[model samples]
Target: MTDFPQKARAAEAAMRAVFDATPLMRNDHLSGLHGADIWLKREDLTPVRSYKIRGAFNAMRKVLDADPSQDVFVCASAGNHAQGVAWNCRHFGTRGVIFMPVTTPQQKIDKTRMFGGDHVEVRLVGDYFDQTLAAAQDHCAEVGAHFLSPFDDEDVIEGQASVAVEMLAQMDGAPDVVILPVGGGGLSAGVLSYFRDVSPETEFWFVEPEGGASLTAALAAGAPVTLPKVDTFVDGASVARIGARTFARLSGVPRERVLLAPEDRICVTILSVLNVEGIVLEPAGALAVDVLEALRPQIAGKRVVCVTSGGNFDFERLPEVKERAQRFAGLKKYFLLRLPQRPGALRDFLDMLGPDDDIARFEYLKKSARNFGTVLIGIETKDAAAFPALFAKMDAAGFAYRDITSDETVAEFVL
Candidate 1:
């Protein structure tokens, strides 16, 4: 047997002591739509509500076993990783110091504390994760604490490999295609390594949020490279660079096999799972599901596993998520329209709206023009098809407007 496969088997055996494998459920909605067996590896149901706990548990276990006196462990994470480390610390009766970005949401911090209990100490460091990471490493060195890499360590990789171990067993063998989410690459790297040895028949497809595709960049450069900027909207997986150790294992993956899911599309999937299935998933957690449309052709008639990585969502972000989902699904739009100063102008435009269209917002922007004034309006419609007809009517009536729904600046300032 391959060494990696052996490691995965060992890890899976140890994992049973903590929690049974997360369910691998065949989703009818997805299967019917895609014409394939679409199974979800529900990593979101882990003890810490994510797969991170596996890596955290395995890494700490190995370290403590090697040196029984190693009691202090330190890690940097803004979300799931922090909670994982905290939970593992409590499980092992060891003390852990977690560093998180100061901007982390209160809900995440509270959850981390709840998991760690008296075993973990939470430190809010820099505004950005990089700075917080640096502070954590420095603190770890100063205090002689074991620095636990969330995704870059060998033991952690072994722990993450447990996911594939459970997956293989749960599927009664191996899936034809395994769809994984790529963040820092630890989970994917470990799981892929295990599958490579035990289930060589399995094919891999990786998904990353479009604005934070560090793995795609690494594959393109043939080395890990930092993104100048990343959209943190998908907080759990919005990594700027792939972990070096994790990337070393992931480097062999074909560049085309790694795809980027649009950030907005991910939001839509989050809403779908939440509203339709009563499953609460964070934006990063839903990346794999959002790519089903792109994978439909290749996955048709095949058994595919989509890793729903984490569910540490904050209800406070619900409004923003719904807003993003609506915009992405073409159910909402914002436009700046020029309206004639004549009294009947607004009435004529209102008469043009379709039965399904609703005026969500209307505000006059400028009144300086002699014949017309600038008006900002937001419209929500039952169908995207309504926009074309509405635009045609506007054109025929000589209305001037600028669609600003997708304009980042406009969205931030006015929308």
Candidate 2:
């Protein structure tokens, strides 16, 4: 345990053969907003657009260095980790079997394939990640291949520590605070371990998607526990259970230090950074940044670093991302309206909309009777405050409506 720092530094040193250290630059935009010196550790800029490569490279390197005859590697990942393993397999000239959920985006699958080229074979195994993982592990045991636990393995944790190793080297001094996005806990565990040893005074904050608050659950239970359900929208960090080995290292963290970023709110941050700073971030990548609002009181006037975790975002999901962001910000809404089947009724409803309100979707479900029709309306406005006045006007004009924007059952079908 005492030699952990040395092992981490060695891993950092070994990484130079594969890729340069990700950038750690002071972000003036975030700094101004938070009243703190905010620095972004741009892990999203890695060759594989994530820090998963660090762990994959290190874990695979150590395995081969220890046993030259061990040439086969197996891993299950739906996103960045798969790409990282594939990339490393190509680098080491080893055969890698990468398993991904059958539902994984084609964009991600393609990228993983492109990264590994001939060195890796991707297997779309199951509809869910757990099934995919089980298959990969079973295959590894049957074939005697090296099974790489994405976050649970010791070597992988050490490799992830390299992020902290580079961070301390890149900065003038230890930052007052370091914000990390928690997925399966490898990155957080490795980073927190290294930082606690090298820079004891540096404070740490962990952020996870609300839909999959594994860290928070673990901290409460005194052990890692599986979440009943996980929202995979922030796929990068939506682990149902935190890694056991990784959680062992992170066990001491206080509950207050663990923040949950709502899935929709993360979309808002993704769009904010993309449009404001011209920095593209996937939902998981935006976790640390999204929690800034919650941490503002504590972080003010402090030198803070936020790890922007990954940028392997599929542009095809841009519209969905935008819609989620708008909904979260209260700038968009969906509702069912009962409209009278009379001439000029549509025009009257349109006229009731404020100048800033725009109808994004207008569809008639069906004419319930000869006198009335049920309509689904999606409205977008410049300000959320405009909603109250619009609803008031509707009430005065005897408009019967049901706000279904937040109704999960209805949204799942119509949205």
Candidate 3:
């Protein structure tokens, strides 16, 4: 059996030829807030803006070293992994065929092309990831090309372990706790395995987006299980199933240590870091920081490290991000209101609003009858507490309204 630590260190050394180690910087803002010395392993600073490049590079390196004539590589991904593989493929002068879902954003596709140049060819396949993956695998077998998994293979896992290999070298001392964002379990499994051998005393927290928590589900079932459905808002770390090879390494991790980050709450963290810290982070990249408030009690007075996984955010989603953040902070709300058609009806309802309330959106849906109409209203308040007072005033004034801010079905169509 191979010693993972030794192989990971070797991989780390090999990666220097392609790109330097990403920064491990202390975050004073997070530290002050948590009353802990918080450091961020900035994997977002990599050449491909993700730790994924390390695995892709290492995996390809091993294959090429074993067989000099092999030059073809294949992978299926819509985001960071595609960029990583594309960038690494160009670095090694290898031919790559990347399969991406048809619905993948053009921003990601263009970036992948920019990274690979002439070294790679991208194929748009199925609309869903599963169909795309199947098409890629089938093509790989047909063409006799090496299939590089996002997280499942041994070499890929070993490549990801290089993250810990770099972190241990960069940190002054052993961190009291390490928080990682989990998707298909490649990075977490590799880091955990490396730390298990080297820094055995370090506590670990694995965070996953609430809507796609394969690791948490796997821990409960004692094996990897496919989720019936997954919300792909956090596209980078929203895997329906944890990779079997990666899960084999992660299976023993305690279920309690796996934290679930709500999609809306992640948007709040994304906005905070971007506005306050001037850091642009994707939903998965912000997962570790999003969980800090929840773990504040345990993290105080301890040295902690949060791995900011990737920074491949599409600026086009900025409006949606702001909307979700505001909603989560309770500063924005949508409601369906029944308003009487009398001349003073709107004036009376407007008077019910607090001083800080602002009507951001207002649209009359339909006249339910000659007396009243249905109105879709979006309100923005200076403080979350303002809603309670505003609601109380509305109640006293005999106004009829239903808060639809949390109604997914209505939000999907109206919000």
Candidate 4:
């Protein structure tokens, strides 16, 4: 029987041929905030800017070693995993076909192509990921190419265990708690499995994006269940379903240990880390850090390690991230107002603004009725509590308005 921990150590050793171990650095800022010794497993520093490369490289390495002539590989990914497979294909001088959803960002598509160079052919497929995955699988069967499962396969899980191996070797002392971000559960399962045997004393906290709480749902059903919908904002970790193989390892975990991070709140963490520490974290990558405050009581006065999963952030999304952060912080809001069509109505509303409240957006939507006009407005305030006072003032003045910031349909179209 293969000693799993020993196998993990061997995997770690083999990974050195592809890329050096990612840094496990003490985060003094986080330690101060949580009153604990906090560290970050910087998987963002890897060649593909994510730890997906670790599993991709390990799985490919074993396959190639077994049969050198087997050089064709296939995968479906909208981001990190595609880049991982692409980079390894080039490194190993193999051919790879990567299928990605048509909605994938151009930046991610470009990065994958750059990493793969001449060795990888990227196929833009269906609007949804499931279709893309099916296309990739069908292509693999037709072309006799090996299909690489992002997290389901045994070899990939074994490959991911290298993260636990490195964490144990890098940390100065045993960690009281280890926080992990979950998507399809590749990294979480691997890390948990390794620690279960090697560092049984360490407590685990697993976080998933609230919109894609596949792990939490799986735990609730005691089986893998698909989320009806997922917010793609946290693209890196927003999987609709947890992998069956990964869930096998994670099923025994207590449901309470699994936390869900709100999508907007994750944006706040992303902006905070970037502004405060100059760490550019993608939304999904910030999952572990975003939940630190909730776990403060348990982690206080103890050693904690939070894995900063990835950093493949596109600068184009900065505005959206900042906007989400502002909304989550209660600093920004959108509203629909009923305005009198009279010439002085706009001036009267502007006069009601407080010293700290500023108009961010103002537009007349319709004025079909001569007496009243439909207006769209956005307001920004210095503090969240200021909203109540502003609303009260508007109410007293008989200014009719509906807060549309939380209205999904209206916000999607107007805001």
Model 2 agreement with the true structure over 230-324: per-residue lDDT tens digits = 89898899989999999999999999999988888988899999999999898889999998988999999999999998998899999999999
Q: Which is the winner by lDDT between candidate 1 and candidate 4?
A: 4
Which lDDT values do the candidates have, in the order given?
A: 0.90, 0.93, 0.93, 0.91
Off by over 4 Å in 4: none
CA displacement after TM-score superposition, residue 394 of candidate 3 (Å) = 0.9
Clashes of each: 0, 0, 0, 0
TM-score of each: 0.97, 0.98, 0.98, 0.98
* Per-residue accuracy of model 3 over 72-179 as CA lDDT, tens digit each: 999999989999999999999999999999999999999999999999999999989999999999999999999999999889899999989999899888899999
Candidate 2 lDDT for residue 157: 97
As for candidate 1, its clashing pairs are: none
Question: lDDT, candidate 3, residue 5?
Answer: 92
Cα deviation at 315, candidate 2, in Å, is: 0.5
- Residue-level lDDT of model 1, residues 168-251, one tens digit each, is 787676789999999999999999988877778899999999999999999999999999999998888889999999999999
